[model samples]
Target: MPNEMNKKQQEIKEKMQQQKYQSKVDNVTPTPPLLKNICWAFVVGGLICTLGQLFTDYFLGLDLPKKEASACATAVLVFLGAFFTGIGVYDDLGKRAGAGSIVPITGFANSIVAPAMEFKREGYVFGVGAKMFVIAGPVLVYGMVTAFIIGLIYWIRQ
Candidate 1:
């Protein structure tokens, strides 16, 4: 009888503690305003696209082919992203710009370099090489798969 009584008391104590924790959690505030974040993201993303277009236009003025100019512009944007991330500026931009910074090719560059930097202390091979692709691996795999599938569909159509 004493054992059963003790067990019941323990259960009630646990239940009360859970309720207390849940109440605390409920009292905590939520994330920032969604509309404001969306606006920032839109603006930042648009600016990046505009910058890339300007680069492309500048290259075109040099008489480069359209495709070559566009590719060069993409390369420039990727370099800027990686460079900023290396200097620790991209993270700040990411925090404020949110998806605005992430929806661009520059964001892809950031993802690749950020992990390598973080894992640098773990050693070059194990730390940097192994973990560098953690963020990009899924993205690359899915992107390749999507491209292949699209290509296959196009081939079949033709």
Candidate 2:
């Protein structure tokens, strides 16, 4: 009975020490500015969208149909995203804009290019080409799967 009691006490003492340590760490950790981050995300995301719209408008003015214009705009945005990522500007933008830089099609381009660039030193076949899809592969897979399921459901309803 005495050993059991001592073990329980020791456990409680250890838990208390852990809590004290956690409290100290919490006190030392600086809190992030939530509102500021949100604002930056909103602004940056908006700008990217605006840029896409501008591209679409430019294509539209060239007598392209709306669908084609939109597609061209998306391609342009993706190219810009990959280009910026290659030049390292996207990383800096990502740091400052956070999810703002991640929620757009450009972000998707960055996700693919970034890993490929990182692994480029390993060679084109084993590194850049393979790792290019590492981050985006699952997203594409799930997206396609979800689309197929949803399409099936819609067809059934029809």
Q: Residue-wise lDDT of candidate 1 within 24-93, one digit each (tens)?
A: 9888958688999999999999999999999999999999999999999999999999999999999999
lDDT of 2 by residue, 67-146 (tens): 99999999999999999999999999999899999999999999999999999999999999888999999999999999
Residue runs of model 2 more than 4 Å from their true location after superposition: 1-28
Best by TM-score: 2
TM-score of each: 0.81, 0.84
Runs with alpha carbons beyond 4 Å of true place in candidate 1: 1-29
Global lDDT of each candidate: 0.97, 0.97
Clashing pairs in 1: none
Q: After superposition, how far is residue 83 of candidate 1 from its true place, in Å?
A: 0.7
Model 2 residue 115 lDDT score: 94
